[model samples]
Target: MKAMIFAAGLGTRLKPLTDTMPKALIRVGGKPLLQHVIEKLKGSGFDEIIINIHHFADQIIDFVESNDYFDIRIEFSDERDRLLDTGGGVKKASWFFDDHKPFLIHNVDILSNIDLRSLYKIHELNNSEATLVVSDRPTSRYLLFDDSLQLKGWLNKTNGETKSHFPDINPDNYNKLAFSGIHILNTSILSYMQHFPDKFSIIDFYLSICSKVRVAGYTPVNLKMIDVGKPGSPEEAESLLL
Candidate 1:
C-alpha cells in the first residue's frame, strides 16, 4: 500500500531546531524524525511513500536522496513554491495513490506504537472512507465520537467551544478521543476535498464533511503515542519510542 507523510510544516512548536532545519529532519534516537516514520510504515507493508516538503525543503530532499530512501520507494510532494497545509498537501498528492486502495497519512512529529496492520485491517473491514487513530488522552482539542465510534463533533478545551454535526440535539453518549496524527483514508475522500484551496487543516475538512461521509475513529487504547511538538514531549518520547 501507499502512504503520505505530512512533513511540510514549518513546525513553529519546535522553535530553534525548526528555525534552521525542517521538523522532519530533527533527530530522535540518532535518526531524523522522517526516517523513523518511514521505517514504521515500511514495516506495515507500505513500501511506497510520499513526503510533502516545505520547511528546509531542499535539505529534506537531499537527505532522503542521500539515504536512498532506506530501501523503500520514496517520493516528494514538493511544496517549495507554496507550503500547503495538511488538507491541501494531501489533495495535491492525490494522484500518487491508486483509486482502488486506501492511503495512510502520518505527521512527521507524531511517533506512535499503534499497530498499523490492525488499523488497516479494521478500516478495510468497515469499508470506511477514512479511519483516524485516536486515544483517550488529554489534549487541547479532541474529536468527539458517538457510542458507535462515528465522528460526531469537535471540541476545543481551552475555550470550551464545541461544534457538532448533530447540532439540533445534544449528544449524550459520546466519547472524546484525541487525534493521534495518523489516519487511513480511502481515495474517495479526494472527491470531497475538491473545493478546499491552498492551505487548510485536514481536521477542519473532516468536521465540514462528517455529516455526509463515513469518518470513523480507531481507538487503540493500549498503544503509546507521542506528539513530539514541544521540547518536553521529546523527553516523554525518549523511553516510549525508539
Candidate 2:
C-alpha cells in the first residue's frame, strides 16, 4: 500500500557528490537514486510513498516536483530544521501511515532484488510487528536471532560486544544476520516507540524491546543486493542493476 523512502541522511560518505546534492539525487544507471527506489516501489505495487528530506532539502523537493512525482502519490516529510535519525524520521511521518496496514521503509541508496509483495505477504502471514530484511552478508554489526529467527540480540564484531535480552542467551548459539536497511512495520509499532527519544537509531530501539515484542528478520538467499553508500557505489550499482 504505502512506503516511506529514507532519503534525509546527510550522506557524508558520498563526499563531493553530496556536497552540492543529497545522496538521493545521485545518479545510478542514468537516473537519480531516489527515482530508482521510487520506481522499484511503484513496480512492486506501492503507489503511495513518503520521502523525508534534510540535506539540500529544497533540491530534492524541486526534483520530485519536476518529475510530477513519477505519476504516483508522493509526499515529503520535512526535516529541514533538524535531521532525525532513522527511527525518529519514521516517527515524524507516522501520520502518513494511518491506514492501519503494514508499510515499507526502504533506504534511498540501497538497491535490491527482493520482492516487496512477497515480503509484505510474509510479514502478514507471520502477524509480526516488523520484519527486517536480513541476509548472510558480512558487516561490522549484525542483528542476532534464535533458531526460529526471532529477534534476540545485537553484536558488534569490531569491538567484540553483544547485547541480548535473554539473560542466559549465548552469543555462540545465535545466528547473525546483516540488516538490509529494508523493513515492513505494522502501525502498532508506533505505540511501542512512544517512550523513545526523537533522534535514536531504529536498530537501537528494536534491540531495546525485542525481548517483549516481535521483530523478526526475513533472510532470503540467492538475493542480489547492493548498498550505494559511498562515492564509488554508483559505478558498482550500475553493473548490478543496469
Candidate 3:
C-alpha cells in the first residue's frame, strides 16, 4: 500500500536547527527523522510513498535522490509554493492512490513502534472510514471517543474548550484520547472535503464529521512512540529509537 509522510511543516517548535533545515532532516540517533520513518514504512510493506516538501525542499530532494529512495518507489508532493497543513497536504496527494485501497499518513517528527499492518487490518475489519492511532497520554488536545471507540468530539484541556459532534451529549461523558500522528484513512474520505483553501489541520476535518462518519480509534498504548520535536528529549529519544 501507499503511505504519505507529512514533512512540509516549518517546525517552529524545533527552532534554531529548523531555522536552516526542515524538521524531517534533523538528526536523531545519527539518522534523519524522515529517513527513519521511510525505513519503518518499508518494513511494514509500504513500497510506493509520497512525501510533501516545503521548508528546505531542495535539500530533501537532493538527499532522496542521492540515496535512491532506499530502493523504494518514492514520490514528492512539492509544496514549495505554499506549505499546506496536514489536511491540505493529503488532499494535494490524493491522486497518488488507486481505487479499492487505503493509504497511511504519518508525521515526520513522530517516531513510533506502531504496527501499521495491524492498524490496516483493524481499519478494514471494522469498515471504518478512518482509523486514528491514539493513546491515553497527557496532552492539551484530545479526541473524545464513545464506549464503542467511535469519535465523539474534541477537547482542549488548556482552554476548557469542548466541541462535540453529538450536540445532545456532554463531552465529559466520553473517553478522551490523545492523537498519535498516525492515521489509516480510506481514500473515500477525500470525497467529503469540499474546497478548503490554504492550510488546515486534518484533525479539524475529523471533528467536522465525527457525528456521521465512522472514525474509530485504535489503542496501542503499549507501543513505543515519541515525539522528537525538541532538544530536551534527545537523550531519551536516542535510547528509545536507536
Candidate 4:
C-alpha cells in the first residue's frame, strides 16, 4: 500500500516552535510528529510512502536520510519552492501514486488512534472516489453528509457560509461532521485537478465534485485525535501515543 504525508504546511499556529523548525519535526511523546505518522502507516501495511516538504524541507530530508528511510521505500515530493495547499500538494505528488490504487493521505500534525487499515478497507468496500475520516466533534467548520454518509456540502457555523453543488442543499438537513485530517483517495480523483489552480484546499476540491461522485465519510468508533499544530496540542497528543 502507498500513502502520502502532508508535511509542507507553514504551521503558523505553532508560532515560536514553528519559527525554528517545521511542525513535522516537533517532538511529541519523544518522537517527531512525522515519525509517528510514518510508523503508524508502516504498521498498517503501507510499504511505499511519499512525504511533501516545504518548511524546513532540508531538515526533513536529512532526518529521513539519517534514519535510512525507515527501512521502507520512501520518497520526497519536493515543494521547497512553494508551499502548496493540501490539494495542490497531493497533485504535485501525483507521479508517486502511478500504481492506480487508492492511497491514504494523512496530515503530519494530526495524531490519532484511528485504524488506518480499516479506514482503507472501508474506502474500497464503499467504492468511493474518496473517503474522509471524520468525527462527531464540535468545530467551526464541518462537512455535511447525508444519512448514508455521502458528502453533501460544507458549512462554516461561525459565518453561516456553505458550499455545495446541490442547489437545494440545507445544512440543517444533513449530519455535520468534523474532518479528521486523514483520508483515503483513489488515484482516479486526480483527473479532476487538471483545471484547478496551483494551490487549493482539498476540501474545496471535494465540495466541487461531491455532487458528481461518491465522496463519503467514515467515522471511526472511539476516535481520539489531536491537531498537534495548535499551541498546546503536543502535550495532549502525548496521551494518544502508544
Candidate of highest TM-score: 4
* Total clashes for model 2: 0
lDDT of 4 at 88: 92
Superior by lDDT: candidate 3 or candidate 4: 4
Quote the positional error of residue 203 for candidate 2 in Å. Answer: 0.4
The residue-level lDDT of candidate 4 at 172 comes to 96
For TM-score, candidate 1 versus 4, the one ahead is: 4
Q: Put down candidate 4 lDDT per residue, 3-122, tens digits, no spaces.
A: 999999898999989998999999998999999999999999999999999999999999999999999999999999987899999889999999999999999999888999888888
Write the residue-wise lDDT of candidate 3 on 74-165 in tens digits: 99999999878888898888888775598899899898888888888888998889999999988999899999999988889999798775
Task: In model 1, state the lDDT of residue 128.
Answer: 70
What are the TM-scores, per candidate, against the unseen true structure?
0.95, 0.97, 0.95, 0.98
> How does each model score on lDDT?
0.87, 0.91, 0.87, 0.93
Q: Model 1, poorest ten-residue lDDT window?
A: 164-173
Candidate 1 residue pairs in clash (backbone atoms < 3 Å): none
Identify the candidate with maximal lDDT. 4
